[model samples]
Target: MPSEAPPTDFSVARIHETVLQMLGAGVLPPVVQAGHPVLRQAAALFDGQLNAEELGQLIHLMRSVMRRAPGVGLAAPQLGIPLQVAVLEDEFDVDPEAAAVRGREPLPFFAMLNPHVRPSGTASVAFYEGCLSVNGLQAAVARPENVEVDFTAPDGTRQQRSFSGWQARIVQHETDHLHGILYLDRAELRSLSNNAEYSARWAQPDIGRARQELGFLPG
Candidate 1:
């Protein structure tokens, strides 16, 4: 007789249990910091890797963590899950003058799964960007001004959307995480600044001043 097949691993079940344990403890794990091997590895696509209930649990955990971090976006890889999922939201509350200068606008909260983005045009804008995983430092990154994105919704619905300005930047930043790309990979390295210095000197709505001072051209 043929040997018996190996026992099922039930990976999804195990993941579900782990998620519930974290939720049950009432203390979510800290965001994984930079330098973790997981942070550099490309994330796997979500194709029923997690069931509906497990997906909701994971998303809830991510939302809570992102809000606590006070960031506009969070990726699954940032939490060490290595899935192509992220949550992003911004009130877009900058003053009118600053908002107009940056083309910043509000983005309602939504969770994107397996998002793919394409630049709308050749135009690019540069701005200071930060990440929870990278922590404590911000750098100027140039990204396309607008993009068309196709993603699966939290409900497993296929969706396509367009984003411009600040929102466009956020989408690209998070999508890059899924591919193991950090903003630093595309940043003007000389423009890197601690949050304090960023607020003090490079805090303008435009990067023109930082560009002149840091001696690097935006892409």
Candidate 2:
């Protein structure tokens, strides 16, 4: 007798059942922390891994978690699902000078499925970044100031757009999550600081000050 082919429908159904069960049970697990293996592994492409209703539940769960975590972004790997999905939104609560320098602005919530991001220009900028997974720490990381992003929208439409400034940073960070990359990987390690210390010392939008103080050049 030949070996049986794996039941792909059964697998997808199992995942769907598990996700819905968690949501229906109203017992959402905390976001997966940094040391988890899921965070280190590249997430799977989100090809119909979830049906419409299941995807909605997952997105709702993610949106709620990100907002409550009070974070600007959250990725599926952060929830231990290991799918290439993430959500991002920024309320833009900074002072005028900071907002202007960083090009910060209010960003409505958006979901990215199987996102791909690439640099749109050679210009790069550095900023202090923190993640919900790696709580209580911020570090300086330089990235392309503009990027082109391609992803699937919630309604199942394929989309592509360009982003710049702070929004670009957010997109890159979340996309990196899908690729098993963390800001810490590209961060100027010397510029690492606790949240309070970061606020007290390097809160300025200019990261050059942090580079001077921390004795490392921005990437």
Evaluate all candidate structures by whole-model CA lDDT and list the values in order. 0.84, 0.83
Residue range 1-219, candidate 1, lDDT tens digits: 122222223355554565566667778678989887666777777788777987898888898899898889999878767778899999746788778888889988999999999999899888889889887899988899999999999999999999999999999999988877788888889999998999899888888999998888943
- Across residues 91-177, which tens digit of lDDT does each residue of candidate 2 receive? 847898988998887878999998888899799888889998898899988899999999999888999989999999999999888
Candidate 1 yields a Cα-based lDDT of: 0.84
Q: Write down the lDDT that model 2 would get.
A: 0.83
Off by over 4 Å in 1: 1-21
**Every model's TM-score:** 0.89, 0.90
Candidate topping TM-score:
2
Q: How close is candidate 1 to the true structure, as a TM-score?
A: 0.89
